[model samples]
Target: MGSMAFSKGDRVVWNTPQGRTEGTVVERRTSDFQLDGQKFTASEEEPAYVVESASSSKRAAHKESTLTRRS
Candidate 1:
């Protein structure tokens, strides 16, 4: 991956099985943690983002590679 170019509250979009989903970056996960019983490993070099879905209002964690900054 490249560098961590996103910050909290940034609007971003990502692809899902249903379609493209838009959301706001809620947090940057730089350490390993568990969400909904699933374990996630994050680091300063390859951080994951916690985003809140615009439509569903649900939160999900995604790697930086899966997200795109919304314009």
Candidate 2:
């Protein structure tokens, strides 16, 4: 897998149950952390992005491979 390259405020899109959802890159997590009692293993080589959905206004974490940067 490729490394994470997204930064805060970056426009991105990812697949969802309904369809493709657009969002902004809220933060980049490089170290291991937990969210809502769920453990997330992240590192410099495999980071996770915290994104805020534009339509639902909800926040979620996602891997870089699952996101596509908007032009």
| Leading candidate by lDDT | 1
How do the residues 24-45 of candidate 1 rate in per-residue lDDT, one tens digit apiece?
A: 9999999998877888999989
Q: Write the per-residue lDDT of candidate 2 for residues 1-71, one digit (tens) a residue.
A: 65449999999999999999999999999998876677888898889999999998888888898999988
**What local lDDT does model 2 show for residue 45?**
88
Q: Which window of ten consecutive residues has the lowest lDDT sum in model 1?
A: 1-10
Q: What are the C-alpha RMSDs, in order, of all predicted structures?
A: 1.3, 1.9
| Model 1: per-residue Cα lDDT at residue 23 | 96
Q: What's each prediction's TM-score? A: 0.92, 0.87
Residue 6's lDDT within candidate 2 is 93
Model 2, position 65: C-alpha lDDT score: 89
Residue 39 Cα positional deviation in candidate 2, in Å, after optimal superposition: 2.2
